[model samples]
Target: MSQALEQVVAELRNSLGTIGEIVGISESATPRFELFHAPNSICSQKVRAVLAHHNIPYRSHQLNIFEGQTYLPANVRLRLMGCIALGGGLVTEHTGSTSVSMGGCDPAVVPTLVDWETGQVLVDSKRICFYIDQTAADGAALRPAHLQNAIDAEVAFVDNMPNYQMLAGKPPGEDHRPESRRKGNGVGFAMSKVERCDHYLAQFADDADLVRGYSAKRSKELNAAQQLFTPEAMRAAYDKAEAGCNHLENKLKSGDDWVVGDNVTMADLYWGVELLRMKNMAVESFWANGAKPAVAAFVDKVESIPAIRASVIEWPGAMY
Candidate 1:
């Protein structure tokens, strides 16, 4: 980690319990890992599912991303550092999911992991999930040696689903999310992000990186603020998500219990979150209308796992 990242982590650790709501397996002394996450985020759910699945012990530093928790000064710095470390001064554009995929990184997001024992700060849900799996207790991992390639492809397929953008803006002339969720977080995140960006732009006027970071976030938010009426953009995202549904349906038609096989792997964990997010988005028409029976059953099966239930389904306001 860079000196800046280490310093930010140090500052964040000082305000842990006060600013963040703690959950997960609490250890008396310092836990081996500390997670900074938001329950509303799909990425956070993915990492939480991995940890819960393997029964790994860690401290959960929960944030309210919709309330601008991720846009707070310290979090902005932490996420900014992670982005810069990934070889970017700041996030200049959006292509796919903010925290995953081959498109680009979102400078402001949640579910950052601090591996205290190893002095490592992990970013990105996909990377974090794999890291947790490989370093699992007794070195036990989810992916079988021979199935590694297949499982990785499945994971990547889930990563490509535009869950973030879907929530940021829904389909034009039609909202598929359940009525209960229509009044949820994603609708106002752009506004929250704007407030934080403006505040930091004035407060961190002298810090070039911080200023640029906040400014970049503000620019993205401004674009998203107008995205609500943009049929083209929303339709494009919907098409992508629709494709994901079709892909999963095809994969599950082979009579597999999980994404890759009967046993759960990193792929299964990721798809669990992705599938649930899709369902909650109320986009199930693609697979729920007696068309993709296998996909529907697989979604229920994935959620049936103890870890997924406790980590995702039970998480209050976890998905928008």
Candidate 2:
């Protein structure tokens, strides 16, 4: 094993205070399904909902990301530093003749799926969710045949919130909080868990270069986000959210409690999580302040589902 991979394995083993568990999981099961994830990870939560929705069973390996576990060399080599094919497969092997660079990208972001039955190891929440929906015969169809386009559109909008970058510190947002306020409260508490990643990672002196680069980039992002709270930025955020709310309102105006049609679909799931995030950030005032009564009712309906509420990681203010 490479030093980085070895380090990750060691950390994984150490965190659980056990030996052979990681390797054992890899080796013991024939046609096994495994999911590597973190509890509070949004993507992870999304995948879990899909899995729960379908009643698909898999082994869960919840990584303690706050302890620098994800930065371990193995995780980088396996998860992030790999070639992800559009449909499903993740190829991490490096060819001697070609240079494959995945610098500064943490692939261990969570909710990685390994389906031993199909010999498929997939990363990315959307892809995994798609895989589950496509492969599983049971469960309510998340992507209904008639509503596919609408579902995709809703997922696109929810996942591509530019203003989300203002709060999340990234385009495809990851949780961002300051290390000093890890234990403190008031606002942005959700970010506290994700922010400690850099500090924990710095203890690995061998990865100093990578650590320094990440720290600098994080600082830059935080500074940029500070500016995103400006009146103009707030207006932009409000407008964007209003646009989404309007779309949802029109969809629900038909008297369907869900986004696309009478039944819950991927669109519902995507917006369910997105709405929860907005609520967490106190941005759901767009609904509460009487701007979109339809949307408000729609969100309430989505949240009332046992699968959505139980499967999704409930953030503060997420529940009704």
Candidate 3:
């Protein structure tokens, strides 16, 4: 092993105690949870928010998506094992790694939860959030059937709309263009070169019709985003998003602090992270720069929650 890998393993051994027995290899069937996540990914943020809300303690394996380090080669996993060993071994019985698959409709996405005990791997943030809500031990409960449905709908809506907007902004042309053409700016530029290459290969395959359709869909979404992003456009999208927020605010306005019924649920955790993004992106500005009392109060209410605060706090040099 490389020096770095050795160091990581040494660290894991120190932290985990007997758990380090599973580092190199072990027959024990203890289920451990490993989360592979990118530091700035929205979906990753959402998952982390849920984890925190549930107060579920698990080891984190940071993947530098910006650096193209999402896939775990055998060697890298070995290094991770080293870290887990140093962390004093796995503490949970349901041991396995989870990630959000950002590969678009593929089964190999991130935000996935792996149950080593059952050898089950689950993808999809909504599903993962629900699982955590149902299984977590000493944390807040996700209850009230109606409230869960509302929260799920809101999360799904918020999640899908941004992708549509992002897709809408691409340059128009044949889908078989060079990688440079496909990767324009913003999130695309920041994506690891490996991810960009994979995206090009996956999305711009031999099928012209498929490529065209994908591009067209993206163009529509980008156009919508453009129209919705301007000072005037911002107002429209903000109004829509705020309606979602207002749904939560109204709930909170009834003297309850959380977005869902009363206590913080997966819904609040999911929305809290998104709102943090919006606040940072100045999305609320379209609706009076968040100066409006209702919006400010709403932001204040979510931000005040301890779990939300921990999950969405600004990282150093995060604003680019």
Candidate 4:
């Protein structure tokens, strides 16, 4: 293992305690698959289930996002230092450093999969899950041939649910500002207290200017959320999650154990992960109260599979 990976494993053990040898455990010398993910991430859960179902082993890198570990210089590099000249004889300059002492992975999202054999690095969960299933030579097949497009469409619908935006800040909406500011603006006023304290700020303690700038940037997001994320929006988010559950309930009413067909498929994996998020968020009553009887039974049936069971991880922020 690299020294950097060793440090991450140590840090995770220190904070999470007895989580077992998770990060840094290599399944092979030249691992074809290496995954960096947070256990609680819904995307991560889906990817894990796909891997488990195929019995594909991977080297794991655990990232705790709430701590800002995902943004750590050791994990994600920021190339912010530059000089820009305005048309009106004005020059904006950065002093001293070429960059903020750069290092870390790019596209710093959780559940990043590095496939050494193919030299491909995948970021999106749906893409990764599809890739794995497609490449698998032998395994429980996850996609029914004719239903692929429908499954992909259903997955996208669940993915766009407003509750997901609520979990972070808010769902994306059109804004004239920069992307971060746009995200902040759409976010509701309420904030989920982070599972871990912000450690990213500490890395810049020696640079007062950087600290101030970063803090101000985050403050703008909070302010925007307060203005945009209102009570009506929050209720709408809840309703959206309920709607996702209702969709699943309707699918299950067909009396099949799976979401799309007789066998497990991408649609089942997609909804399985989404429902897991609902369970973690404490709003599963949307399922319990609104969904039909078959919905719960379907969940019970899917989660009972050895692959799915092995894929389950404890969410640090789960309400229950």
Candidate 5:
């Protein structure tokens, strides 16, 4: 971490004991990285599941995204630094919950990973998970070379779905999430994201990096605001996720237990979280429910995996 960023993380952690705690014990003399994540974020869940599945160790700092902890100036600065490192620019569009899913760097969000010794700040859950998977010694690769192409396809498939947007806005006729869990209970923050970013934008107007970061985030929210909860937009989001599940159902009908190959791979890891997210939202009506026994069974099997279970199913912020 940069000297300035180091102080910021230190300050954030100092008060984290109340709202955040580390998830795993460090396995090496030197820690690999520190994760700034949120317990309920689908993206964060994917990363946590990867760490658990591979038995990798990390310092986990949980953020409450709804409360805009991720929009804090320090966090914004860190995310923007990550954006620049990846050659990404200001956000002018938002088709997905996070920019990473839409082929851009995220200047605002949780689950940012910062390396310990190198200070390499990694954003995007898929990149972070693949980083941990590929860098491990023998017998630890999640997307092994021979399976890289296939695994990547599966991962990208999940990334293509509007996972976050599906929850952000619910179609009254189609949404099945429990009443208390709908709209405001857990996923309404996007409605106020622009205003929230503005609050911090004022605090760091002079800090060039902070100004750019806040502005990028505000732009992201502004772009998404236009269609956040319109009935058409909400239904479209649901259809997208359902169509994704249907595609998986067709793949599984071939009698394979996993998305690709015979054994569990990174593909399974990504789909497990995706399925879990839909399940929690009660949004599995047509594709993964009783009518689609194959897909339903697959969802059950993946969620039961010990590692995935701990990482997401029992996460503190998980909705029923």
Candidate 6:
């Protein structure tokens, strides 16, 4: 941990009595749900968006990847280290770590959801969104029978593509280099990317600016793995995304207020957050950037909704 984060952890422990445990452990008897995530992670954003739409209260635990806190507890750390070795080298190391204790053994990525009551922890963003949709107090049925498969396919697509974009933008040899090459390189490289992106984002001064900056930097970095952001490639990706957006635009145009159905279902929340990411990436879209009248109208419509608007708006320093 950096001196800064170490200090933050120390102060938190002093204030809350334990380093890793939730704050105000005695506050209420209500079942608590905790989301472990990084601030600018898209998957994390998706989960938060759903929580906001469903009005499900949750505790947010910010994990610092640089500090290796994501692999806390000795066994998980070693297992992660071993996986890094077996994947033909450091390319695998760059992948995130997720242990069963943290919920599952898969994605090991952020936006992990833990239901404190049932001790059920789910890792994938889509699955967690479904859980919230089916279980939250305000859970309204949003996926129509005709559109369920389509919406599910879209969510799955969104879940996987952002990570590919992130990996594609990195310096060559950085992601797939040998572990020896990264002995002291991982944290520094990650932090430097963070700084550069922050610098670019300094131009914007509003909450939207922060969101845009963070999302843009992340998209750029994830796209580094391929190291090729040629216009053709970007356009191709944008074109595919545009199709998804149009599907949504048509849905909205059909007199339904949201993408999946009449209500703001998990489908709406999922696509809404994903579109926010695409918008930040400056992907050409007919609806969002005034490129398409119907699409732009749909963007306006969703943003006008109180819950959806509130969910996408950034809260910089607020914990949780």
Instruction: Report lDDT (CA) for all predictions.
Output: 0.74, 0.56, 0.47, 0.54, 0.75, 0.49
Residue 88 lDDT in candidate 4: 22
The TM-score values for the models, in the order shown, are 0.87, 0.66, 0.57, 0.65, 0.91, 0.58
lDDT tens per residue, model 4, 106-140: 22235666666764556556667888999887856
| Ranking of candidates on TM-score, top first | 5, 1, 2, 4, 6, 3
Better of 1 and 2 by TM-score: 1
Inter-residue clash pairs, candidate 1: none
Quote the lDDT for 59 in model 6. 65
lDDT (tens digit, per residue) of candidate 3 on 73-190:
3213333333233333221110011211222222112444444444344445666567767776754566446676767765665564342222222322232223433454333332
Can you write out model 5's per-residue Cα lDDT over 192-278, one digit (the tens) per residue? 888887887787778888777777777767767775556677778777777888888888897776888778888998988888888
List candidate 5 segments past 4 Å from native: 14-20, 27-30, 97-103, 172-174, 183-188
Per-residue C-alpha lDDT of model 1 across residues 126-195, encoded as one tens digit per residue: 8888888888874547777888999999887787777666775656556777665466335375666778
The deviation in Å at residue 255 for candidate 4 is: 3.7
The parts of candidate 4 lying over 4 Å away from their true place are 1-27, 77-108, 163-228, 289-291, 313-320
| Model 3 segments more than 4 A misplaced | 1-31, 71-109, 144-146, 163-195, 198-256, 287-292, 314-320
Give stretches of model 6 more than 4 Å off. 1-30, 64-108, 142-147, 160-235, 284-290, 317-320
**For model 6, where is the 10-residue window of minimal lDDT?**
90-99
Give the per-residue lDDT digits (tens) of candidate 6, residues 1-320: 23432343344334333334342233654436766665556666667777676666666666564444443322122223223322322121122212122222322235566566765555556666777777766435445456779677656545544233322332223344233333432334444554544553454435452334244334534433333344444345445556666666666667765665566665666666666555554453346446566666655555665555655555342122
Model 2: ten consecutive residues of lowest lDDT: 94-103
Model 3 TM-score, all chains together: 0.57
**lDDT-based ranking, best first?**
5, 1, 2, 4, 6, 3
lDDT of 4 at 202: 68
Instruction: For candidate 4, list the clashing residue pairs, or say none.
Output: 75-104, 188-229
Model 2 lDDT tens row, 265-313: 8878877876766665555666886878888877788778665776664
